[model samples]
Target: MRPKDEGACSGDGMAGRIITVAQQKGGSGKTTLTANLAIALRRKGFTVAVLDTDPQGSLGRWFMERLQGVGEDGGLEFSTSSAWGASYEGEKLKRRFDVVLIDTPPKIESDLRPALRVADLVLVPVASSQVDLWATEGVLDLAAREKRPVMIVLNRTRPNTRLGAEVAAGAAALGVDVARAQLAHRVSYAESLGRGGAVAEGPAGPGRDEITALADEIMAQAGIEGAATIR
Candidate 1:
């Protein structure tokens, strides 16, 4: 094992709960959600770390920006744990981080398998579109094969659309848990990304509230009581 202290620290002391943010489809907001959720959880006082398993390296750059000009008590930490290197860095860091947020690439590759194999929960971001919904099946099938607790969160959803209902029904039919809160389509999320930090740290606006709500839903699902559990 890596012996911890490699990437970000998730509060609660690495209880073997690895949350993987993944989807077989691109543009599903998997990385975005992973980044923000990690920060939100850290804000809740949990020592959180992010495992940037994707090859695209978007999450890596985001972390670089977040780390710049920041003091030691930064909210979150980021690390790169590829599929082949999973047994090394990931397993080692798990011993230290309270919660590990893993960002997987799009597709069921060898790298994805190792990440999923270690995950306590899998959060899949699904856009409000028929194609994206259909694409979710592949990942869902993989999760089923692994018997992991998978939850779907609607991302960048249009206001008052039937997509939420449809996604809810689809997830229910597949026996996958769906988040109660759907993140609405907002420029703030994108804008925050452009600024290289979390929406919560950015200007106060609707996106911050949405991220907070989503984080609460995730915590509730995980049975986490308060920020104390994280710190």
Candidate 2:
């Protein structure tokens, strides 16, 4: 992918695209996606910043571990904010980064609007389960009200399984755009995050490929041009 021009704006006068990863269901891989996607974007030659709006502070903890392990942030900036402060903090980071990703807490309600309102795109991760699919409604409804574009990502899927097929079909019925790229059940994702790094930093494998594809698709959905081709 070509590097973004320094003066390129998000077309709304913002210097960067703010992508809020939200899901009402807990354990939907919100922080995992945020951390891995941040690393993926950085590798694609885009400066990225991650904003952790969840009170749980999981994303913030991961960044701290990454700092300790690597002794540096690897050009990826990180910060924390309250649910209400997401807009302010995210916008502030946008000025200096190519992408700003907000990792929101579980449970969708009025509190999620502040973050959704400021997003160029809202990414909803739905794990391969009927329960996970059901939990996505509140998030989809909220994003619809905010008029933000949303993409459903199938996460932790078990390929070639009946349950996986069922969940994929169920997600399609929600009338939202489901990403063609899906993240499978992989120990690499969890193990890497435990070390404050991403699967992309490890040897080339399916885990890295899944993240790269999803990142490219997300950039396309956000109307950003020149996403890196899958390696």
Model 1 alpha-carbon miss at residue 218, Å: 1.6
- By summed lDDT, which 10 consecutive residues of candidate 2 come out lowest? 1-10
Give lDDT tens digits, candidate 2, residues 1-231. 234443343344547789999998899999999999998887777778899999998898899998899777435788888998999999888877778899998855877998999999999999998889988998999999999999999999999999999999999999989999999999999999999999878898999999989988998888666645334
TM-score (C-alpha) between model 1 and the true structure: 0.85
| RMSD in order of candidates | 4.0, 3.0
Number of the predicted model whose lDDT against the real structure is largest: 2
Question: Over the stretch 1-231, how does candidate 1's per-residue lDDT look in tens digits?
Answer: 112332445354545347888788899998889888877777776667788878899988877766664444543557886666654566665566656788888865555677777777788898878788888888877777788788889898887667766765676676678887778888777777655667766665777788888888777666555654232
Q: Model 1: which ten-residue window has the lowest total lDDT? A: 1-10
Per TM-score, the best of the predicted structures is 2
